[model samples]
Target: MTKPAVDLIIVGSIGIDDIETPAEKREGLLGGSVSYACAAASFFSHTGMVGVVGTDFPQEFRDTWSSMNIDLEGLQTVEGKTFSWGGKYHDNMDSRDTLFTDLGVFETFSPELPENYKEAPYLFLGNIHPALQLHVLEQVREPKFVLIDTMDLWINIAKEDLEKVISKCTMLTLNEYEAQLFTGEHSLTKAAKKLFDLGTEYVLIKKGGNGSMLFTKEDTFLLHAYPLDHFKDPTGAGDTFAGGLMGALCASGKTDKESIRQAMVYGSITASFGVEEFSLERLTKLDRDQIEIRVAEFKDMCKI
Candidate 1:
């Protein structure tokens, strides 16, 4: 008997982290693009994760993903240590500095999708090397929609390869700094326009704390982040947002503009929960009731 294809497949990094804020420090926390993305996506859709870990990767983390019903048929474990990142966030919670990044098993991570995952209608290529993103895209069948996320490092390093990946994706997600750096446009409108020329159907620019904006050939939509006073850590926020957007889109079974817009709102609302605690602490405990209530608040904020 053949297995069923999941609603979405997320391929990216899985790691351990040491994070510090002005008030406290936490270590040995589960932190990775796939870890957060898969968790967020699982709320609205059947999600699958494809990534590489090491022998040292914790069984607890694996158990967490399993509890979320995320398909792990594509997860590979090898001999090295799991990837580990260390960062320190400033007092204002706006900017941070990277202390270190030990790419143990992640250095050579090349995602291989399971046969069931190849038929997923939605695919989120998380912030990984552009070359690897393209490799995953190749394995999947004709995807109905593909959303790719990236960082400033790729714009500075593997730009040509990154652009190739951008040309093939349905949407691209980037933060404000990366948008300017990638397009050489001070104005976000122009930056998104420049990216449109690269062949992506939509461009979503994430503005930390402030909000996010979505741009397409025909229109643009800007959304404010959910107002939250109890914020703790911002780690994995972007990945969580991407996961929410793609998962909501898949669950809706529509790739139209209006569907994409609604999905963005869900993305922002779900991500807001992640920042309320360290790592996935807040996200794992979240349920549909909390999300729906926040969605109501989001609608009230927009008056829509």
Candidate 2:
């Protein structure tokens, strides 16, 4: 079999974000599920992105991604305003208020993968409409691994479609509340089991600040968040986590339980860098050495 042109393909939103945290406020920063995910994943593997943006999208942003070697052949530039979102974070930084969300081109986004991306070895379905996620899946030739991230909005409104998407994915990632709401079970273990019945091989439950849990039929792995002295903004942390996890998995070319656990640690470390600044500011400047040092520190802290 021929090797894929890219190690990973990400299908999701690309947007500009206006953020207001307790400590500061910033507007029109580069932000989106695929943006963060692709950025994090690029540190580990060859990554491609598929998402729609408007003519108003900055050319400099495009240059930055291109410099990172991210394949943007799948990025569609239409004739409208790019998707924009505004949020205000609380002091704790674990929760936020959606000040506004202008879907713009994203509202009508129909991801169309480029011919070269059709054979990507790994795929990540970002938090987009379930129908669109399924559409992208149909276009892909064959993926060695597939993971998806979803939000509460889709769960409440388009659950039937969401479940169909879940059934086809190798892994599902969502917050703790979304997991409980989807399964109607207060215990995460039961919720994970319920999700397994939905046909996904693994379920990752994200707990902001606290940590994350990975569940498979045979084992469960718990990982703690890397402690930070201060947090600047929480925007894109979850997507960054997903990117790092998928990036590590793709780079290592492994999908076993041990590989998944190691990927989670990489995810956690990358996410800690995300919260240190707004948007992808800190993450863009990171190198493998910085990531390796942090991961080593985490191992030391958690050693038995």
Candidate 3:
């Protein structure tokens, strides 16, 4: 029997990480942009993940993605070690230092989407090299909506290429610092104005725990992060938000302004749960019912 069409495709790095927080440290954890985003998106849509790993990757992690029903046909496994990173978070939980990095097989990553994924309705370019993001875009055929996330590294080194990627995406997601770095404008409004000149239809600036703000040619929208007594780890929260946003858009079957507004809230709530545990532990345990409860509770908090 033929398989159903995939609603979303996410492309990014897949890695194993050693993380040290003020409280403790863990090694060989499943972590990466694609891993976090794909898992979160699976909760709301039929998602396909495109990334490269190594033979050293654990079977149990593969089993986890399988359990989420994420399409793995685009996942490539090859010789060599999986990309690995080590980080230590400070007492504030807002700042972290990279202890080490080993590119391993990831240094040569080249995303090649499955034939079935070429026409996916939604595509998310997770934080990866701009050239790679462009490579994936070249393969996709007329995606209904495309979202691209970038970092300061890309803005500093590949400004020209990153600009091209932004021009093609329906929305661009980045932190406030990255926005200023790319546009040289201290005011976020002016920074967004420069981005709009680049041709993206929308811009979403992530403020981490403070919450997020959305910008368009005509209006701006704001969302508050779900209140938490505290969160254990924040490694993948941003990726989770991006994935959830794309997934919610797919679930709604519309990309109108109202749908975009609702999807932003869904994305924020999903990331809130992810930070409660280490690695992907909390997100792996998340279910649709739990998400619905919090989404409603969040809406109630906003009502006058």
Please provide, for model 1 over 1-304, each residue's C-alpha lDDT reduced to its tens digit, 9 standing for 90 to 100: 3445788999999989999999889999999999999999889999999999999988998998998888899899989999999999999988999999999989988788888888888999999999999999999888899999999999999999999999999999999999999999999999999999999999999998888999999889988999987888999998998898898999999999999999998989999999999999998899878988999988987883
The most accurate candidate by TM-score is 2
Model 3 weakest lDDT span, ten residues long: 1-10
Stretches off by above 4 angstroms in model 1 are 1-4
lDDT for model 2, please. 0.92
**Residue ranges of candidate 2 with Cα displaced over 4 Å:** none
Ranking by lDDT: 2, 3, 1
RMSD of each: 1.3, 0.8, 1.4
lDDT of each: 0.92, 0.92, 0.92
Compute the lDDT of residue 219 as modeled in candidate 1. 89
TM-scores of all candidate predictions against the true structure: 0.98, 0.98, 0.98
Query: Any residue pairs clashing in model 3, and if so which?
Result: none
